[model samples]
Target: MSGHPVLTMKDVGVCYFRKRGFLKRQKIWAVRNVSLDVRHGETLGVIGRNGVGKSTMLKVMAGIMNPDAGVITNYGGYSVSLLALQVGFLPYLTGRENVFLSGMLLGMTRTQIAEKMSEIISFSELDDAIDYPVATYSLGLKARLGFSISFHADPDVLLIDEVLGVGDAQFRVKSAAAMRSKIRSNKTVVLVSHNLETIEEMCERVVWIENGTTRAIGTTADVLRAYMSQVKGRAVPDPAD
Candidate 1:
């Protein structure tokens, strides 16, 4: 990665309002004062237990959700997108139709979607099913189609949630290869996953988040070592170890 930052978050925070029935409501902060930078062509992994606001941070970066505090700056006119399963699909629409719809939602033009339809369908392996309504698709099918469309969208910055965990073994391998191809093309990626091994393999750096805050951020080895130590209920090992 170069010295330039593609995207940067400065003291960002997001909150949700939960209603408890009658007149009771509570304000919960999903993200808290998290600051980080995403550099060009770097694959940054975010590893954490569920409900730690990692996904929320991606939403903020993708401009889907705004932070209640702080700021997110985008440099170089980069386009950011969040790729997650079971999203961006219109249940009543056919897979072909949803391709256009979803692509548009991801900021692609109609002409671009038309041009890439064949490649998207082939990559998704949805052949005949591409004509069927998305609601009729199985879980794995949804993941395959969603991932194919997003991966081919060619965004400047891609924020991947746990969608990679959804597909079958073979498809996972294919998808991982596609992601590597994107990385090779010098695209910026922010990946959030429960699989630390994949994070270690795919990411140059990893961020460990706990309870809506950054627990550690550094090289993949350093951050994952610290994260795994906590997971196993042991003290963090020395860097030399």
Candidate 2:
């Protein structure tokens, strides 16, 4: 890690309103007071239980959604891409078309996407299905295409949310290998996952979120130990031991 921050979030918060009977709405804060810095060339892990706003935080970081409170500063104008199963693909468009669309959205030029088109399709293993409309695709098929496109987008900072488990066993292995390659290249990454083992192996630092706020932030071992202690109701064994 270079110890230089590529992105920084200061007291960032996102709110939602849900209907609560007639003329009344319940205010929900999905992410409340989250502050952290994403250092360049480091893999940062985000760990939390379900519904803890992990995905919400990622969306804000990717600029897909604006925070209702606080500010986010993107130093050096680094490009960020969010890798998720539910990629913003036009259902009516073919897989090939969606690849171009998603790539452009990630800041890739048309010529760049065109050059990588064949590789993306081959990596996805979509074959002839690449010409088929995405609306006709199964969940796994869509995931394959999404993963393929994002993998080759080559953004400065990549945000991943529980997408490593997508696709079949073979594709899962391939995708995992690709992600490892990205980390090895010293690309900045923020990973949100429930797989503690993956996080432990890949991330140098971790941020633990609880009740829509940061509970702890530190070395992967330290934060994971504290998180596991709370979740398992017992002490966690040190990795060194």
Candidate 3:
């Protein structure tokens, strides 16, 4: 990894305001005091139970949402792309059109997307369905399209949220290989997944989050072992029982 970080988040927090009654509301913090850095060329895995704010952290890093506290520092003109299903797509548009649209949204120019169009289509394995409206596609199909476009967009930093398991078994294998290729080429990645094995296999470092807070951050094996130990500890029957 490079000496300088592409992205650095410091003590960031995000809260959602939900209506409670006729004249009251509640502020629920989805993530709090979270600090991390995306060094050049490193794949960082974020592993946690569901509803622990992993997705919220990714959204904040992608600039789709602002933190309610702390700050995020972008070193320079590094482009970051968030790979989440159906987040920036138009259901009325064809899968082919959405590829260009999503690619542009990820900071690729028209000509750049045009140059990569064929490869993106081939990678998605949509075949003739690429010309069909996105609304007609299944969830897995949308995920394939989204992953293909974003992966080919070649952003400096990529934020992925529990999306590597999308699509069929064959596509899953293909996508994993594609991600490893990007990493080999020194692309920065932040991946959030519940699958500890994948995290251990793909990440150099891992962060464990719990209750919207960072519980541990270290090498993949170290953090995974700690996280799994805690999970297993919780699973054991209480002595009082």
Each prediction's RMSD to truth: 2.5, 3.0, 4.2
lDDT of 1 by residue, 1-241 (tens): 6357899998899998999999999999999988888988889999899999998999999998989999899998899988866557988999999999899888899999999999999999999999999989998999999998888788889998877645899998898788767766667889898877778878988887789987777889888888888888998754434
Weakest 10 consecutive residues of candidate 1 by summed lDDT: 232-241
Stretches of candidate 2 above 4 Å error?
234-241
> How large an RMSD does model 2 have?
3.0
Ranking of all predicted structures according to lDDT, beginning with the best and ending with the worst: 2, 1, 3
How many residue pairs clash in all the candidates, one count each?
Answer: 0, 0, 0
Residues 173-201, model 2: lDDT tens digits: 99999988888789999999899999999
Name the candidate that leads on lDDT: 2
Top TM-score hit: 2
By lDDT, is 1 or 3 better?
1
Measured against the true structure, the TM-scores of the candidates, in listed sequence, are 0.91, 0.94, 0.90
lDDT (0 to 1) per candidate:
0.86, 0.91, 0.84
